[model samples]
Target: MRGTPLRGAIYGLLAAAIWGGMYVVSDVVLKVIPPFTLLTIRLILGAVVLLVIRWRTA
Candidate 1:
């Protein structure tokens, strides 16, 4: 995988898509929540999700 350029490109595209989706959702949610509050909630939820995934895989 280290030397595979296509695999890296795919990963990059996937990451961009995920972030793009997050931005669009956050944009819509901004009407009901303040920017700081939204950001805080997103950070906490993202951390929890990553931790859960790590725990499960480990």
Candidate 2:
């Protein structure tokens, strides 16, 4: 009950942290991998992740 007020702030910090990590990883990956290839990989990975999440929920 006491933590209710802090939920939004916590989620905001988590989102920032996730995005910062992605930026660092993308910077390193793009040096060796082409942009289109990276985009394809990200799309595939996102699809797999979403599928797994959906399967689990069902």
Top of the candidates by lDDT:
2
For candidate 1, write residues 1-58 as lDDT tens digits. Answer: 3569888899999999998898788778998899999889889998999999999999
Per-candidate TM-score against the hidden true structure? 0.55, 0.68
Q: Cα RMSD (Å) between model 1 and the true structure?
A: 3.1
TM-score, predicted candidate 2 vs. hidden true structure: 0.68
What would the per-residue lDDT of candidate 2 be over residues 1-58, giving only the tens digit for each residue? 5667589899899999999899889899999999999999989999999999999999
Error of 1 at 16 (Å): 7.1
* Model 2 residue 56 distance off true place after TM-score fit, in angstroms: 0.6
* Residue 4 miss distance in model 2 (angstroms): 6.4
In model 1, the clashing pairs are: none
